[model samples]
Target: MAFVPAPGYQPTYNPTLPYYKPIPGGLRVGMSVYIQGVANEHMKRFFVNFVVGQGPGADVAFHFNPRFDGWDKVVFNSQQDGKWGNEEKKRSMPFRKGAAFELVIMVLPEHYKVVVNGDPFYEFGHRIPVQLVTHLQVDGDLTLQSINFIGGQPAPSPGPMPNPGYPGPGKHNQQPCNLPCMEGAPTFNPPVPYKARLQGGLVARRTIVIKGYVPPSGKSLVINFKVGSSGDVALHINPRLTEGIVVRNSYLNGKWGAEERKSSFNPFAPGQFFDLSIRCGLDRFKVYANGQHLFDFSHRLSNFQGVDTLEIQGDVTLSYVQI
Candidate 1:
């Protein structure tokens, strides 16, 4: 969403070889470039397409490439809506063949955060559920400058140490605890935990979901998660909103429990990201914001832990996440 132009980061117009940085978390990727040594016939035909596959043999695939109209264009094929949508034109700028553009793509539960040239660009949803994306191809004239996967090291930096106040594992027997964690915008002072982040690359729940930043106010702890059809979840603090489930007697449960004590947040805007913390255990959940108490609730008769699917209906950016 934001831009940082450094002094030595010059553009590489027609880089001859492919340059790559591998991604961690056992994720695999492939890279290839079709060199149109003769530029005329392939001038307009030049295109780069990356095939995102769950595994080596999976048939379901996601495709992405710069738009065919010309250079400096970025586009993707969405499998959920079954269409090829063009991203905002300004998302990709000053495109050139063989230029050193790196896509730091992390595939989350429901969407993919795709960062191009050290910045975030788009969040493609209804994502391909496979663990690996192993194909990259440049359709024309472009040179495959270099290829490498950002493997081994943990890409994102570790969050600040959990403070003594953090409840140990699922220990919620007592109430009102603190957590030793980082608050505020992520900094690159010591190499941003992950690579550069992009805007609109994160997906958050649009409806029945509230969005906001967590400033270090008074409380400590933030809980964010998706509850399943039969589960109950709740946020306890100054203010929060509930979606899908409801608040019953003492907790938030499924089956459209309660519509009272609703919290309001500005609808998610484009190109903005927020960090949240959440803890899930047994049949109960609690949410906090920026070290403050928003609210808390519990669920009954809901087997939600097994439902791992989460989808972000709108664009939101995420610097890092802890499972």
Candidate 2:
């Protein structure tokens, strides 16, 4: 099937062979891309390029090529002003011929963090700020399934942002939960209508980050922070895109509660990316999208103990649920 990208998004060519993608605004901190596909059964090599322009011989910020033609290693390098740099070789290949793979590339301030099939793979030090790279090129012995990019300059901080703890719990009454290290943060990939136990349940200042794309055919997306056992939704962030509004409500003992549908702006759009965050405050749940404070849903349920499980369902493709 042909690949259909979102409006203003780059499209892939010859899905089974090679393709070049244009990064409209380029890559920067907070930007991550997910690539899902397979290596050819008799694959020899494949390359994914981060380049500055669409023209030939343009500077390449980073070049990632994995070879399996007997010389089994991944080569990484960079080109600037037309001069090629020394090649850095990584001596591991986690890919199998003809096997499917899920790769995530996260652009940080210093380097490009790569995760292959959900595990730490390699870190390619940035030869240049990746944000300046304007195009992404993929080619060689691979069958491209899908290439997706998400994230952008976060919504300007609504106010002072809260800095949370890492790989551990947070203290009470913290304003925000800005994690210092992305690698140390816990991540989850639950099934749709997903529900998972939040270790030690909820604590003040604890936070959750959900990243995903709004489906092109999306109607609305709903996220509920509630007691896993009793199914009481404490903060139900229901963005009813069809109505051009977000409806925040709760469910108690299986009955829907009064809705909190007021918002300063509608932060969602079909075929866009959203980084929805919810942080536990002393008396209420603080919600933010892209970084802008959306609103709050005060404590409602009798037992806040069940803030242990997070449930999300709707027309969205979740990249992860990081707590």
Judging by TM-score against the true structure, name the best candidate. 2
lDDT of each structure? Answer: 0.32, 0.68
lDDT of 1 by residue, 1-323 (tens): 11111111111223353322112222322211112122232333343334443333333235555543545556555333344443433336433443323444545456655655335667666444433333444444444422322212222335532222321222321222242121122221122112222122112211111222222231222222333343343322222222312222323543334444432332112222222333333444434332223344454325433333233221223323322
* C-alpha TM-score for every candidate: 0.30, 0.52
Model 1 gets an lDDT of 0.32
Kindly list the per-residue Cα lDDT of model 2 for residues 148-179, writing each as its tens digit. Answer: 56444333445532221111121111323342
Off by over 4 Å in 2: 1-17, 154-309, 312-319
Model 1: weakest 10-residue lDDT segment is 1-10
After superposing candidate 1 on the true structure, give the runs of residues whose Cα lies further than 4 Å from its correct spot. 1-60, 68-72, 78-94, 97-99, 132-138, 152-323
